[model samples]
Target: MTILTIPITFDKSHLITIGEKLYSESIELIRELVNNAYDADATSVRVTIAEDEIIVQDNGSGMDEQGLRQYFNIGSTEKRQHNRSPKFNRIRIGEFGIGKFATLAACGRFEVTSRKDNFAATVTFDKEEWEQSNNHWHLPMRLEAPEILKTNGTTVKLNKLYKKFKLDDVERRILEGVPIKAEHFEVYLNNKKISARFLAGQRIPVFEGSEYGIISGELILVSNTNFIVGGPGIEIKVKGVTIKRDLFGMEINFPQLNLLTGEIHADFLPITSDRTGFIKDSPGYHEFNKVMRGVLQRVLHDIKYWQKQKEKKKNRRIVNATVDKVLNALKKNPELASLIGLPVSPEEEKQKTEGEILPKKPRVKRTPAQKRMVSKILGPSAVVARLKIGKKGISCQLDHFGQDSPESYTESNIIYINLDHPLYVREAKNRERLIVNVARLLTQELTLLKNPKNARQAFDTQSKLLKDTLIDTTP
Candidate 1:
């Protein structure tokens, strides 16, 4: 009798069959490049896109030969000379050490070129080799010292495009992922500046205040007011590689709200590839959170305060509608006047004195605008003004008797707006611009309402905003 036996040995980690990693992870790739740009000290960045090509160029300080080799490594083992962190002070915006490889997901080929002190070099990443090889994480191309290069910045060219690309969409994604300023480090998508910050749909002016935050003890801070309002993205600090992003979702949903919905500029908030996903517990997250702790609460308080004002306005509208309905019904049914304590008979009313016998229709109540003014001036620090009803609308008065303001606002700023509307006009000193803008918008809406042929009324509560009065802001 003859017997045969076979022996087998395999490593558990390498058993999986799919050795090739798909390049569908586009957003992270773009993010890596953007973060690297920040590390290069770039104030002006450009992201250019075509059907088959994606280019990211930044004007940050370029790299030297030794710097290039160290940057190519996956980890910053060489950068550990200064132990706390390898990135620049927070003012510069990078902290993590791994965003560089993100770009590998976008193309079959990628190239990087940088120059420092009159010397330049180029490096290529071959994706085919990465996918075909057993270990898919390392760069396939060798770093060759170039004979000549004039410019002193880094450029990454991603070829054999992995996914369909669109310029508008990609630009938007960059805006959300890397909140850079147009003036400080102007960012352009196909040479056009992005505008997605203000309700006006244009760039907001830079608030003249500069501040910094210490995330991982790197210089990370959001400076200026205008850029955040324009279309600012994010900055990462990794030792090697560049990443790309999806370019659409990140810009619109970066902070879980509209671009104009909240304040911007916090460094330590590391990000993942899509650009919308932020790392909440990064090395310096807690320190960064310390600065933002009260800020978010104040923002929430402002929103709630606005909401309460809206509720009051809604109630006012109902009361006004009820008053009008009662008046109309009263004219048609004169018989019920006596039940409401009005004159019973026409002859009896004629015999009575001119003004003494008949009671005036119960005076409708009103609220004074002064009360609302005080609330706005004091904001969450104080309570809102009290209100009284009038025959047609409501009058609001400052609720606190001890409060007084010698300072006065311009007539243009003294606008009485009902809370039901969502028109957030930018900061302005002239009311004409705001009023005219509102008028044009409302007129357009009215035109639509007049021609609403079949469905529910266009002028219904859900579709329109009503503002019937204006009070002066001057003392």
Candidate 2:
């Protein structure tokens, strides 16, 4: 078999602007180098921003003569062919071969020192010279005695800084960009270790069944919708590295703002040459959107359910306040308190239970105002009330009312307003109506306790009179 070698030709000047064309943001340049370190299987990578230059150093298998040649190849796929790191078997992140050259986007010149086995070499790239060298493509290089470190590794120095940036801002960008999740891989910026932000939320699954693969991630519910734009969103991750910060470029009918913030780890997702985002039209990306759409729907459902729970809690709190006031009023009024004793005889218990001796008809009809008060406390349906507050100000599940009736008359001193009533839902919303209704119930109970003979009759009379007179006033 014969192997034929053909030279691939392109404008060498393209190298000068290749980085700029690929990366619009300056922070992307830093990500390119860190990805290279990850591709090298470096356990630890340290990036330093000095007075005049930025240095990125890693401890991993470095390059020899052949390796360096492959590294400089304009669009080499050496990392892709290898597929994984030699030591850790980590998925390589720099397959497009533009990462190293991307440094030119941030600096005018840069130097790389690498060592492997007993061989070590240093190479310097001058962007100005590359652009002016009459199309010459070679960078200055030298073979050297290994002094970089005892172990195999690579160090890249970007000098003649193109732009100045805050160290803190740079660190934050790196934190969001790099794949710091791989095992045995750690990154340090200015000697301080960069830790992945703690994302706390519910986990959602992506691409459950597809030709590509499935990835799992979590959705953190954020309150501030604006933060979702500035902070990271459903990050699109490939090879454990976040390719897209969020669903910024993609077309998504997001259910709500600040509703879905999270990271997805889909290694099969295709990315652009700059590695800043994913290929939007690719089948893999489309599938990701499909899976995430389902996730967001479920997230929206959860949001609705949570809101309902909160509203219930708020209504329960209002019922609790009304109950507390009634109890306090009963405690202060001695006459009402004296009427609160339990029946000692079986006959009295029967009379209270059956209401046989009481009036057969309702002495007073519900006025519209009183009716509205009941609706306010009970809510629209007034079918179920799950929350109860007692005299102790303690919350418990007590069955004070057995039926869906307007009110439950019990000998116990505790007042359990039926929040499920229509009137409580409507009129009890007003403070004056709530107080009047509470007083009406209290007077009814006191009359029942005062005279078992007329207890039922007096209770009915007082309830009707209170409704007609007290609720007649304007809300």
> What are the lDDT scores of the predictions, listed in order?
0.44, 0.66
Prediction 2 global C-alpha lDDT: 0.66
Cα RMSD for candidates in order:
15.7, 8.1
Candidate 1: lDDT over CA atoms?
Answer: 0.44
* Alpha-carbon deviation at 308 in model 1, angstroms: 3.6
TM-scores across all candidates? 0.48, 0.73
Q: Pick the candidate with the highest lDDT.
A: 2
User: What digit string (tens of lDDT, one per residue) describes model 1 on residues 308-385?
Assistant: 575445434443443333333333334432222233356744443233222333332333444444345533222222
Off by over 4 Å in 1: 1-24, 77-90, 129-150, 199-305, 321-475
- Candidate 2: stretches off by over 4 Å: 1-9, 200-207, 223-232, 247-257, 334-475
